[model samples]
Target: MRSKVGLVDLVTRYIIRQKGKKIRPLLVLLSSKLAGGINERSYRGAVLVELLHTATLIHDDVVDNADKRRGLWSINKVFKNKVAVLMGDYLLSRGLMIAVDGKDFDFLGVITNAVKRMSEGELLQIQKTRKLDIDEETYFKVISDKTASLIETCCTIGAMASTQNPELIEALRKYGHSLGMSFQIRDDILDYEGTSSITGKPVGGDIREKKITLPLIYSLNKVSKKEIDSIKKLIKSKNDSVAVKEIISFVKKQNGIEYAYNISRKFAEDAKNALTVFTDSQTKLALESLVDFVTERKN
Candidate 1:
């Protein structure tokens, strides 16, 4: 659905055709079942999460000047940047309208906080990217806000919509947060380890973008001061294709990949541990399997 005035509807429809993994909505549904049972409210919450997620992807493509999304032309690439931005705004407003119409004020509050945290995280990353001064603590904070907050919202909203138990909601929130963290760390690792065909982007793309991800961060901490300085110079410089490749190699040689994997595994375990309060059921096992999928996914 789009404006009656122009090509917005067609473009929006095109975007909808390029569907993603729908992981967040799946989480909402699964969490609903885990907490209590699915209902109309659960479906509404899933729709809201998907809408906001799609909006964010539109906006992210514009900001990153991305040409491809999910192996297809990005909205900005096909519709132009201004149209993409307006479409993102349209989707965001539509999501807000759904919450308002449903009178789900509590859900609205959770989503609003997620949006705020995501914005703050993006800005903070941009600021740190200038200096490349990201430490371990800052890294966790950035991922928690930017990547985990919405996942947390999905699980929390799903449980809240279906169940009256505050404890169940809290448990799902923690589960989602830990799973999201592990998910993102795996994504970062893929940037260094996966091929273009597998990841839908060139390996070392993040390094070229000067993104100081967990692997690079862990490697930097382990190397000698001179080695660190050299690596920093390469990152701070133009970061051409060769330099990015070298940086990737250095990270691998320093065992950065292994270090990051270990950390990601720990978070995945924590995610599984969060579900212990629930009784054994197929829905619970599905949630547990999702943890394995997140940590083991190639893309």
Candidate 2:
């Protein structure tokens, strides 16, 4: 118990200062209370979601070779990639211990399954990186796994822990799924539409990494075959600043950003609709507000 407490402290000391919205943990708690009630077990599940989310950010910084996160030096920038990865693993282990020790077996299943899906999603994206022909259908599946799975897990576990009703659980899960998709699309759009000064990241970072996000994917679908070949060749050059700039401009002309934003709004609306079965409550209102927050977030 002492070791566990010490480990938790170490993890918290590293992450507690990080600036994030903590939306996932909020979802866990909100959904739980909306479904029926909140208890010690529900708070445990929310904490586990937060730990898992922080672990993912650590690992993602290592993989993306990102130096800055939330406008500050990331763990990888300060301690090197090895330390960052180990810290991520430590956080995951701590979350697991918390769940199992609390005897929240069902929550354990929710999170472990989400971790599995998240790993597979990352692998899938890595596998397709630099592949110019990645289609729209495949893009959705990857984002769904990488982003939506955990969001869904947060809501589902919250519902299950608070309510035994299968229907309510299912409704909240759908709400989460739609919200998660909207959230990812918004992030992808920010990579293109937002400034580094605002978003706290470099412009064209996704393009530099050869990530086929929504705007690029839409531009590819709308552009000519000749343009496609030109863009593909430039991306393969491995140092195609000129090409990256051109792609961003072309995406704007093609209304790719607008299209992606529309899609995000649609999902946000769908998320709100998913909660129609629930009677009005503060928790339900908070969930609806979360949908508005997703579309409005700048970073």
Candidate 3:
């Protein structure tokens, strides 16, 4: 992130100071270690994935007009949308340059594909938000592209860095797919029930954004048509605080949270099962532990 520009340096400092969970890079490192051992390519792959993740998050903040990220002011809140958008582009360009300099075409292909999927997923989600009529399949499609693709890329790049064995690479990819699904499902659950102190972000941001998630989807199917319409109206209303509170209560009463937890757990199990390709080792254990952590994380 080094640059002659003073604002670029300043924004770089601001972003690094309060890094989030950093789960993507960790997956990269761990997968590389599990497959063989960490090398220079492993580090490069980690840096590229993290750059893409951060850039997307920065762009997302601008799109959402977000005030905070993690527990602090978002890039848009501090630097305004203009600077934030440019900063995201800067990070992306830096990542591309890094891959080009290293001649890591595999990394470049995976990252470019991820970028495409992320853009499509975000646009689809926006469309669904406007209509507020997302189904379970559509919900999966959104998260699979927007969230899961990033995680899958981490594992993909990492596996490529360590080995050319197609079986091993495919195994890690499958593991990443399920892990990402459970991770986003758990995240959606937290938006409804997580504590502000724990998650940093205020609860019910999804409802405020008019986003329908798995929990609400399951509950909506169980209720009467009249009740469902009323709940939808509450969500669509401009009164965010009241809507958030009422919707949270409604989702909990309808057992949406419980249903979501069960589903996330199943995905977690699937993630673990995918790791059966590798022999038992500390690295394998760590990878499996990540599955539990993603499903059970408070934030």
lDDT of 1 by residue, 1-299 (tens): 55795687888788878979999999999999999999988988999999999999999999999999988899999989999999998888888888888888888999999999999999888988888889989999999999999999999999998998989999999999999999999999999999888777888888878889999999999989899889988887675887888899999999999999999999999999999999999999999999999999998
- Displacement of residue 233 (Cα, Å) in model 3 is 0.7
Better of 2 and 3 by TM-score: 3
Residue pairs in candidate 1 whose N, alpha carbon or C atoms collide under 3 angstroms: none
lDDT of 2 by residue, 1-299 (tens): 12455644654576677879888888999999999999888898998999899999999999989988787788888878887898888888988999999998988887998999999989989889846667789889899999999999999989988988999999999999999999999999998888888887878888888888988888888878998888777666665778778878888999999999999999999999999999998889999998998888997
| TM-score, prediction 1 | 0.98
Model 3 residue 154 CA deviation (Å) reads 0.4
Q: What is the Cα-based lDDT of residue 197 in candidate 1?
A: 86
Q: What is the TM-score of each candidate against the true structure?
A: 0.98, 0.94, 0.98
Q: Which regions of candidate 3 fall more than 4 Å away from where they truly are? A: none
- Per-model lDDT: 0.92, 0.88, 0.92
Error (Å) of candidate 3 at residue 285 is: 0.4
